[model samples]
Target: MSATIKDVAKMAGVAVSTVSYALNNSPKISEETRRKVVRAAEALNFRPSGAARNLKKRKSETIGLFLNDLGGPFYSQVIEGVQEIVASHDYNLIVCSTYGGENSSAHRFLREKFVDGAIIMGTAISDSLILQVASESFPIVVLDRELRGDYVHNVLITNEQGGYDAVAHLIKLGRRNIEFLSGPSAAFDNTQRYEGYKRALLEHDLPVPKRIAMHGRFLEAGGYQAVKLLLASKRLPDAIFAANDEMAIGAIRALHEAGLRVPEDIAIVGFDNINLAPLIRPALSTIGHSKFEVGAIATQLVFNARKEEDVIILPTQLIARQSCGFSGGVSEQDHDNLVASILHVGGRTKH
Candidate 1:
C-alpha cells in the first residue's frame, strides 16, 4: 500500500495520533509539528484513509443530505451550493431521498450512525423523524420547517415576509381584492404565506373573503384548479397571489385560456422567484430568496454542528417583475443581464 498515517508518523518521528491531530489541523497540535508531519506525509506520499480516520476519530466526516425529492429547480440548486462548500472542506456527502414516505433505509442509516451530520431540506423531513434523529443525538440542520427542539438547528427564510411583499406589491399597483392560492394547509410555509396574505389585506382594510383565500398544492395544476374553483363562483378577485411560482404559472395559463390578460385584466404575483418566473410571456413578478445562500448556510451549519456550534437564520427579498406590474426584468436586455449575472459570483443576485 501507499504510505499511511503510520508511515507519516514514523517518518516524522511522532505518534500516529499526533499525525492525525496535525492532519486534521486540530488546535492542540503546534504549527511547527503540523508542518513537519505534513512534510513527512508528502515525502512518503501518505494519504489519509477516510475509513481509518473516521474509525479513530469516531466521526464519519460525511454529511447526509436528506430531502423529500431530489428533483426540482430548488433542490437541484440547493444541492449545488452545498456541494461547492463541502468539496472545499474535504468532507464527503451522502445524498438520501426520503420520498414516498419515511424511508426505512434512511431511518436505519440515521440510527446506525451512517453520517457525521445531516442537512434536511425544508419541511420534507418529518417532525417525527426530526424527533427520532435528535433522540439519537444526531446533529441536524433543518430547512424551511418551523419545528425545532433543543438539538435541531433551523435554517429558514422568512416565508411570511416573502408572502407579505408579493401581495403588498400587487396592492401598490392599485390592485385590490387579491386572493391567495396557498400550499398544503399543514405545511409551515403555507401557513406563513397565508398569514402574510391576510396581514396585508387587513392592513389595507380590504375585505377578507372567507372563500377567496383558497388552498393550492404548490403546483401548476393546483393553481389551475384553485382559480377554476373560484371562477366557477363568478366572484373573481382583482388579483391573485400564489404561494409559489409553479402554481402562479398554472394560474396564469388558466387565466390566459379564459381570455383574461395578465395585469391588464387581473394582476398576479408568485413566490419563490424560480427560474421560469422570468422566462415565459409577461415574465412573472415574484418574491425572491437566496436558495443557494440558504443551502450554503445549512451546509455550514452541518459542518459547525459536526464540531458543535449554534444555529442560524437567513433573510429574503422581493423581486419585482412584469406580471405583478414591476418595471424590472421584463425585456431582452434584462434577460441577458440575468444570464450574465450567473457567471460572476456566489449568491448571484439577478434583476
Candidate 2:
C-alpha cells in the first residue's frame, strides 16, 4: 500500500498535525522540524493530496471554459487568447463542450463550481441555469449573449450592424433578390444577422423573400444542402448572404456544381472572416471581427473581482474580397466609410 500522512508522521516520530504543518511549511513548525518531516516524507514517498489542500483553502486555482464544440478554425485564436490570460495568473484552464446539455460534463462543471470562475461561449447551456449559478463570489463572463445577472458579464459581437452592412453592400451593387441562408433560429448571432438582412431589404424597399432557408448546422455541409434545396425551387436569388463563412463556402460549392457563376450570376457574402474565407477560390466577402480579443476580454471580465454587470461589444468590420465583386478588396477610403457606418450604427469603438 502507498504511504500516507500518518505513515510520514509515524516514521518521523511526530504528530499528524506536525507532519501537515511541516509539509505545508507552516511557521508554527520550526525549520529543523520541517526538514526532519520532509526527510521522512521523501523516504516514504509521501505526496500531499491536491483535493485536501483545495478544500482547506476553498480555492481550486482553475478556470472553466464552456464551448459548444471544439470544431473548425474558429476556436483556435479564442483559446489562445484565453490561455494567454490564464497562464499569466497561474491558473489551469479546463475546456469542456456542452454537446449533451444537462447530462454533459461541461454542464456538471458549471453546476458544481468545479472552477473558481467560468467563461461560457455557447447557447447549449440554458440562461436559467447560468442565472441560478452565477453569484457575487462566483462570477461568469458570457460571450455573444445578453443576459443580466448580479455577477454575469456579457461580451458581445456587433452582429446586427455587420449583417446590415453586408446585405446593404449587396443591395447597393444592385442585387435585389437577396436570399438569407440562416442557422438555428434560437441562436442569438444568427437571429441578429437575419434581422439585419430583413432591415436592409426593407430600407431599400425590396421585397423580403416570403420563405427563406432555415436550420443550417453552421457547417459546410449544411450550407451545401440549403443551397441545393434553393436551386431545386427554380428561383435563385441575385445574392446569397450566409450567416457564417463555412455555410457560404458550402453555398459556393453547390452553386459551382450547378454551373452557376459567383458574382457574375450571383453574389455572396458571409459573416465571421474565418481563415479559410480568403483562401477559397474567388475569396469570400465576410464580416470580420477579432475573435481573439473577444476571448481575451471575456477572461479579463472573469477576473474583474467585482459584482458590477459589464457588457463589452466588440466591433465587426466588412471585408470586401472577390466574392462580392464590389471592389475586389477594401481600400483606405472604404475603411473610412466603414468606420463612419459603424459609428452611425452604434458608436462602438475598437478595443
Candidate 3:
C-alpha cells in the first residue's frame, strides 16, 4: 500500500495535523518541523493527492474551453493562443465541445467544478445556463454572444463592420446585383454581419432582393447546396458575399462546377481570412483579424482577478485579392510580391 499523511507523521514522530500544516507550508509550522516532515515524505515516497488538495482549497488550477465542434483549420491559431496563455499562467487547459448540449462532457465539468473558470466559444450552450452557473461566483468569458451578468464577460470581433466592408467592396467594383450567403440565423455573428450588409446596401442605394439572399449554415456543404439552388433558378448575382471563408470556398466550387468563373462571371468576398483563403483559385478577398489574439484575450479575461464584468471588441481589416476583381492597379510583379508578403506572414505557400 502507498504511504499516506499518517505514515509521514508517524515516520517524522509528529502529529497528523502537524504533517498537514508542514506539507501545506503553513506559517504556523516552524522551518525545522517542515523540513523534517518533507524528509519523511520523501523517504516514504508519499505523494499528495491532487483531488484531495483541490477539494480542500476549492480551486482546481485549471480552466475549460468550450467550442461548438473541434473540426476546422480556423480553430488552430485560436487554440494555440489559449494554450499559450494558460500554460504561461501555470494552469492546465481542458478543451471540450458542447455539441451534445445538456449532456456534453463540458457541462458536467462546469457543474462539478472541475475547472476554476471557463471560456465559451459557441452558441450551442445556452446563455441561461451560463448566467445561472456564473451567478454562483464562477467566471465565464463568452466569445460568440454578449451577455450582461456580474460574472459573465464577452470577447467579440467587429463582425458588423466586416460584413459592411465586404458588401461595400463589391459595390465599389460596380456589382449592383449582389447576393448574400449567410450562416445560421441564430448565430450572433451572422446577425451582426447581416445588419452590416443591409446597412451598406441601404447606404449605397442598392437593392437587396429577397430572392438572392440564402442561408449557408457557415459550412462548405451549405454553401455548395445554396449555390446549387440558386443555379436551378437560372439567375446568378454579379457578386456573392459569404459570411465565412469556408462557405465562400464552397460557393466557388459550386460556381466552377456550373461552368462559371470567379471575378469574371461572378465576384466573391468572404469573412475570416482563413489560412486557405489566399491559396484557393482566384484567391478570396476577406475580412481579416487575428483569431489568435481573440483566444488569448478570452483566456486572459477568465483568469483576471477582477470581479466585474468586461467586454472586449477586436478590430477587423479588409484584404483585397483577385476574388473581388480588385487588383489595386498593381502589376503582375506587384501582385506576386503581395501574395509573397501574405504567405510570409501566414507561414503558408501556394501548392
Candidate 4:
C-alpha cells in the first residue's frame, strides 16, 4: 500500500536511478529536475528508504553520542541539548556507551554506517583509537579530550585552571595539606586536573606529598574507597579535591560515616558540578560544565560538518557551594554556581 521510489520514478517520468540522484540533491542533477522529482514524490505520497538514500549519499542523517558510561545525572542534560539542536533539522540521534571498552557495540554502529557523524565523550578513549575512527573520514566531535586533526573537532574545558582554582581556594581558606582524589590514570581529564593540582601547590610553595595524592575511578565508589584509605592512614588532609562531584560526594559520605564534618573538619571540592552536587548534604564545590551546552555544541559540530562548516567550542565554569565551606540557599547557590563555574572554566573567572 506504500508508494515506493519506483512508483515515484514512474510518476516523474524518469528512471529510478535518476530519482535517487535527484532526491540525494546530487550536483549532477539540475535544480529544475530535483524540483520536479520532489513534486512527483510528494504527489504520489512516496517515501524513500533510509538505507537506499544512505547508499546514494553515503550519509544517514543520524549522529551518534558515544561515551564510556551513561550511568550519571550529567548525561541527561547533554542528551537534552543534543536533541534540542538535532531536532531542529529533523536529524536522528543514537546514544551509545562503550561500557566494556573501545570496540563496543556503540563503536560498531559507527563502522556499519548507522550514523554519519559522532560526538565522542570519555577521556579514557586513546588517541590511537580516535585516530582510527577519524580515518573513516567521517566528521567527529570529541568531548573531554584535547584532540587536533583534519577530521577531529575538540570541545573541552579549562580543566587545569579549574583544578588550580579549587586548590587555591582551599589554600586561601587557610587550609594547607590538601589531598587530591584523582580519576583513572589513563583518563585525559584526570591527568590535566592532577597536573593543575600539582601546579597550584608548587606555585604556593606547598609540598606535593605523594601520600596525599589518591587514585579514584571518578565514581562514588572510587571516592569512597580513596577516602577510606586516607582515613585509615596516619594523617588526614585538611581538604580533598575530587576530580568529579560523584567522587566528592563519596568522600563526604566516608567522612560522615567516620563522624567527621565536611568543611569544618575537612573541606571538599570537585569537578563536573553535576546535578546532584547540591543535593548531597553539604553540597559540592565543583568546576561546572554545561552538560547540555556540551551536547548542543557537539550536535552543532556534526551538523556543521554535514553542512561543510568549521568546528566550534563551547565553554566551562566553576560553582561554589556548602561542600567547600559556603552555606545556605543550596538551590539558588546551585544555579548561580553553575553560571559562575561555566564562566571561570571558560577562562573568564570573575572574583
Q: Whose TM-score is greatest here?
A: 3
Candidates in order: C-alpha RMSD to true structure: 5.6, 4.9, 5.2, 4.2
- Can you tell me which runs of candidate 2 are displaced by over 4 Å? 1-49, 328-351
**Model 3 off-target regions past 4 Å?**
1-3, 42-46, 135-137, 329-351
State the lDDT at 309 in candidate 3: 77
Question: Residue by residue across 1-351, what tens digits does model 2's lDDT show?
Answer: 889999999999999999988887899999999999999999999888988888866788888889998897888878887888889898899998899879998899888988889999879999999899898667898888889888998989989988998999998788888999898778899989999989999999998888766445788899999999989989888899999999999999999999999989999999998889889987889898777677877888888856878888878878888788966446434755765565346444433
TM-score to true structure, per model: 0.78, 0.84, 0.89, 0.84
- TM-score between model 4 and native: 0.84
Worst 10 residues of 3 by lDDT: 342-351
Highest lDDT: which candidate? 2
* Per-residue lDDT over 1-351 for candidate 1, one digit per residue giving the tens place of the 0 to 100 score: 687778888899999889989999999999999999999998988888878878877878788888766665657768877887788799887888875455544555676768877887645556777667763336787777766564667777778887887777788888897888887887777788888888898898887777545667887888988888778878787899998888999889988888888988888888877779889788888776666666777777666654233445444567677787775323434534553454245333221
Q: Evaluate residue 328 in candidate 4 and report its C-alpha lDDT on the 0 to 100 scale.
A: 29
> Candidate 4 regions off by >4 Å?
9-14, 18-43, 135-137, 211-213, 306-316, 327-351
When 2 and 3 are scored with TM-score, the better candidate is 3
- Cα-lDDT of candidate 4: 0.78
In every candidate, how many clashes are there? 1, 0, 0, 4
Q: Quote the positional error of residue 260 for candidate 1 in Å.
A: 1.2
